[model samples]
Target: GRGQAPATGQAPPPEGNLRARLTSFVGREEDIRVIGDDLARARLVTLLGAGGAGKTRLSQEAAEAHARVGGGWPDGVWFVGLAPVDDAEDVAQAALAAVGARDTKLRGAAAEELRVLAELTSDSDPLHRLVEHCGRRRMLIVLDNCEHLVDAAARLAEELLARCPGVQVLATSREPLGVPGELLRPVEPLPPEPALQLFADRGAAARPGFRVEDDLPAATEICRRLDGLPLAIELAAARLRLLSPRQIADRLDDRFRLLTSGSRTVLPRQQTLRAVVDWSWDLLDEGERTVLRRLSVFAGGCALAAAEAVCADGRLDALDVDALLGSLVDKSLVVAAPGDLGADGMRYRLLETVAEYAAERLAEAGDDKEATERRHLTYYRELARTTEPRLRGRGQRAADRLLSTEHENLHTALRRALAAGEVGELLCLVHALSWYWQLHDLRAESRHWSGAVAALGPDPFA
Candidate 1:
């Protein structure tokens, strides 16, 4: 009875229970161990990082390891990749289907076929039933790309954790799902050593006799220049099929330009590292894209206050700034970091690649770009103007923050304003940035701005 199967033609049970094992893994032993350890100790673990950071691969490794170790639960490991299914409700259905759960209420043949699962299985709650079927069985359920429906993921995780004691969930996302009992593992970029190793490995696979000895330094340089990001490194290595490692290193000097080629079969956006970023950019609404491009004026990071001041020219309300920043963070276009401000909570920055893409978008947008740049310059110029009077007061910090964030943008805007024959705006900009120049010991820049204004003839405001 234990080994026999019914009339439906399902095969008989195996002679011995054979656990699944991962056949190969590369460059992420430490990460795999960390996630595996967390899954062993906690009921839920979230692997959080930017896109293409190998969350899926790491989760697979951990699942395979759990299957091998034996004592956690005997049922087996189940992984459901949620990337294709966008709806939250469908996620549960997909998981149920993956675990052989069937519903019986349908009238159509297709529905009946699906319903056979529920009729055959003895468990009541589908999710709980799936877990119970794996009773005393250590099961790891992976929820990949949870960032899209974070709230839904959190609710589902809570339900599973509450009802299914034997099940462990390994979730991977761009951001954390903020669930209790969820251990967040932030995945950093691959380390330089393994990154180079990966490059050599892939390169050798593409071309024979691709040794590391001759190309080690150049390979290392490529990794460093690409910020040790795996996807970027892989894309670089793909070029080694045609170019030498040294030539690849040389091309990386203008990485934005050089990192154009990607896998031929993949989606255009996924083909190259630039395409990945461009895909994210394409997903932005016009308003968000505009705000993002305007934000590129800042070199460092920007405060909500500064963003509102510089980015809002009657286009976006000040109240919308926070929400916009949050959206950008969720989209991976902007990153949140600790800030020194007590009033506002955090500072936000763009990745270098994202910033460059935004800058290009701004330049292409023509008059809108110039107009937004004017607003940006005006805001910083006003900040500079206001700070001079309150150098000894609290305003100094605000001024300094603005100056630091908007310095490059301010410089670019000033040059553009002068070149556009907006002499009045140029004078205001020069006068406003004077205090910033003095405070930051930028005497040369201050002199330059002052000369530009002077050349514009006598200022009407003066």
Candidate 2:
């Protein structure tokens, strides 16, 4: 997800927002191929991910690689950024302006044909005119940041796909476009190796001769804590001009404060980690917001049943937790693993950075913090109490696997219970987990919690 990896040799010609990247694009070789393949067969393809997870960078690279390969898009690859385009109705005009730039790069009959399109920019119905022009042209139109005006983006994509015989679309959105034939591809966070490579690459770019191996552990931890998000990694790398890697890693607890001063040229949201998340946060409705913040109580992620128990009351009132959680997942505010729990059991999580954002929201919104956590504590403690017996015989393996997945939640509940001076709940939790802990050989952790249960009181996150 390196935004500006320096690709070797002749790169795709720059156009619209797809400037020939100044740096070699990193770690999306497979993605580029997949996108190219998808576009070959599908008319509409949308890249989906949490904000700041490199959807834009990946889409741009994929589109560029497709164009670089040639023969696929004879009219060229075009990128139209819908981020600054505020209204749905204006999507057509913004697109016309973007694709109109294509005319300048063409020659002969192709150039003349697009020149006709450039002149039609002022048409009374720009969409129809634009579609009529593209009706037979083989081109890749990259609709960037379409989540905010998704309905319009979807409608536009649908019309183009249906009417234009040779047009293909590559859209980057936090959510799916919901168009019938649209392909949704999730751009995940970088794994350890690539995340470290990205950090080292950006770190050296920020400060000449900077090396990640000089302080491998700190750099590793920084990437790990940032959950391998490229924008976050890039922002942290920028701090190398001033701070040591250790210093940067140490201050990441206040990341929104420390990871600042990104390149001022990009959109304000892309310029800062907080702003990037804020853009996504602003897109959510109140129910989605509530479920998101409350679910932040889970140290890792939790099953839907656990989410319902912990987040469905309070201001959520009669709203269905399942639907709310699903909406959050659709919006990319939450990540769901469909098979983690069982056939139909989906486990959901927020990215650690996004969890921090949700925690901040929880604190800012007030009293729901304690109420939601209390429910979380109650749910896990009761789960422990119930699962205790199941740990003994015929059900031991099933129970152990389930509890293992929830071990972080159990530990989280133990700490929260201790902080709140709920000695009674703490005792029950420890007593229930005592054998499970020993079974998993968590001697030290067992000792720590068993000791804490005896010593109770103070210190837990809000």
Best by lDDT: 2
> What is candidate 2's lDDT per residue for 15-46, written digit by digit as tens?
44467667656677777777767776678888
lDDT of predicted model 1: 0.69
Assess the local accuracy of residue 396 in candidate 2 as a C-alpha lDDT between 0 and 100: 94
Residue 413, model 1: Cα distance from true site in angstroms: 4.0
State every prediction's TM-score relative to the real structure.
0.71, 0.92
lDDT of 2: 0.85
Report the C-alpha lDDT of model 1 over 287-384, residue by residue, as the tens digit.
78878998887766777777887677666787676677678776656877777655564788776667777888889988777777677767666765
Whole-model Cα lDDT of every candidate shown, in order:
0.69, 0.85
* Model 2 TM-score relative to the real fold: 0.92
- Model 2 weakest lDDT span, ten residues long: 1-10
In candidate 2, which residue pairs clash?
5-23, 5-24, 5-25, 6-23, 6-24, 7-24
